[model samples]
Target: MIPTKEEWIKVLNEKHGEDVQKKLSAATVAICGLGGLGSNIAVSLTRAGIGKLILIDFDRVDISNLQRQQYRMDQIGEYKTSALSENLTLINPYTELCVHTVRVTEDNMEELLREADIVCEAFDKAEAKAMLTNYVLENMPDKYLVAGSGMAGFDSANLVKTRRVTKRFYLCGDGVSDVNDNIGLVSSRVMLCAAHEAHAIIRIIAGKYEI
Candidate 1:
């Protein structure tokens, strides 16, 4: 049964308290990638009543992505941004979404992310993660950045963690795990790290973080 928009808002306010819900509803988060981590994080924030989301990705949903991505089988061959936006609207129709179908580059990064209250690093590639991290910290020093690293495999859920790297930077994940031969990203661990990034965004917006 699809709940009415007011019904969804009421549920969110009751669960998060009016003040936190308001904060969440006023924040805009920009997510760099729409793979395992970004997809999960986007769903979480949407369910939490985030006002707007900016999603960027150049890839489409593939069969191999079913293992950890939030996409359904029917979404195969669809762009990740489009698939995620469709799913997010189902979760919260009132939410606003801005999608970029192009790959993030140094030339366009600042313009793409300038309006966001928080920037989330959700790329699967290590180099992409590092590049986005450096660019955001250097150019958009005022924006809060929540990023994940080292979240791969199914070894230990507790290994996924969150830490405040700086006043405006937060890092999530094991900080050492990576996808490689014999080790791959499973939904459990990937979602765990994604949850940390989502929570960090909430904390920063809700004034629940110390740094």
Candidate 2:
């Protein structure tokens, strides 16, 4: 059975301390893509008791996504925004979710992410990643951006590290590997990068930014 909201919050408080838990529960995070990295990052944040999430994605789950994404075989063909929201709700019922089954573009990004304290960029394409990163850094300077760079291939897991790019911009991954290199993405390594993004957001919420 699922625990009561109070019971869940109490456990989080015990683990995170009251102040940190409060901050985590009050923050809103926007995940720009709902694929491997975004889905895993969303799961981590939901499990950490984040208050709200704005899930944006324009793709449907495919059989190929089963290798690294969080979608189930039964969820194949479903829009990623919908599928991920369903999964995240199961992990933490108390976390509020606002999903958009649309692609994130410069025109809509500002309005979609206006309420988010942190924005995570998890697009699969380099062009898309650069677009979101440039838009957020130039337009949404106040919000923290955690982006994934190079989590593809069978590279050393230790190579996946998070770095603070600017005061509000942070990046995670090896900074070298790419799927186009034909190495492909491994589940464990991709999740490691996702974990870094999630942990960075949590640390930011806890008021610790010296990464």
Candidate 3:
């Protein structure tokens, strides 16, 4: 049986101190692109008890996504925003979710992410990644952005590290590997990068910003 909301919050308070839990529980995060990286990042943040999540994606789950994404085989044709929200609700019923089944473009980016304290960029294409990164850095100056760079292939897991790009911009991944280089993405490595993004956001929420 699912735990009561009070019971769940108490557990999170024990794991994270009361002050930290309060901050985490008050933060809103927006995840752009619900693919391997975004899916895993959302799971981590939800499990950490984030208060609200804005999930944006324009794609449907495909059979190929099962290798690294968080969707189930039964959800293959479902829109990623819908599927991920369903899964996250099952994981943490207390977390509020606002999903948009539309692509995030230059025009709608700011409005969609306006309420988020942190924004995570997890798009698959290089152009898309650059587009979101540039838009966030240029337009949304106050929001913290955590982006994935090079999590493709089976490289040393240690290579997947998080770096603080600017005061509010951070990046996770190896900075070298690419899927177009003939090396495909491995589940473990991609998830590792996702974890970095998630952890960075948690640390930011908890007021720990060293790495």
Candidate 4:
């Protein structure tokens, strides 16, 4: 059954503790994709009671995305931003979601991520990841960027880990794996990395992130 706004708040506060819930309730996170990583990250963050979310994705849900992304089969063909918003709101009725169904580019990086306390990068392409990483580091210098790099295939979940690239940048996943001819993505491995990215955002917002 779906919880009402007040009931959801009570449950989250009890589960996360009042202090941590407060921190999460005041945070704004911008998720830059809605594939395996971004879709899962958005759900986790919402369940954790994050106050505001800026979801950006220009692509529509596809049949293949059902294997790992946070979309139902009925949602196929709908814009990812729209599909995810519906699901996330169901989890946390009080959470505010700002959707932008547009592609991200270096030219628009600043405008997209300026208000985010933490930027979660979940693009599928390596060059796209690098592009956003560099853009965030250079333009949104103060924003902590949590990105995934190596969660692919059915490799041991232990291999997936988070690494701090710099004071303002962190990479999650095996840090060496990638989806290829042999390696493929599954929900478990992808969600592992997404959890890392989501938790990193929480830590940063709570002022508990450590090098």
Over all chains combined, what TM-score does candidate 2 have?
Answer: 0.98
Point out the higher-scoring one by TM-score: 1 or 2.
2
Q: After superposition, how far is residue 83 of candidate 4 from its true place, in Å?
A: 0.6
- The number of clashing residue pairs in each candidate reads 0, 0, 0, 0
lDDT values, one for every candidate: 0.92, 0.93, 0.95, 0.90
**Backbone clashes (count) for model 4:** 0
lDDT of 4 by residue, 21-95 (tens): 888999999999999999999999988889999999999999999999999999999999999999988777788
TM-score of 3: 0.99
- Report the lDDT tens digits of candidate 3 across residue range 97-139: 9999898999999789999999999999999999999999999
Give the per-residue lDDT of model 2 (tens digit) for 12-86: 999999999999999999999988899999999999999999999999999999998999999999999899989
Q: Give per-residue CA lDDT, model 1, range 121-152, as digits (tens).
A: 99988999999999999989789999999888
Candidate 1, TM-score vs. the true structure? 0.96
Worst 10 residues of 2 by lDDT: 101-110
Q: Residue 7 of model 2: what lDDT?
A: 100
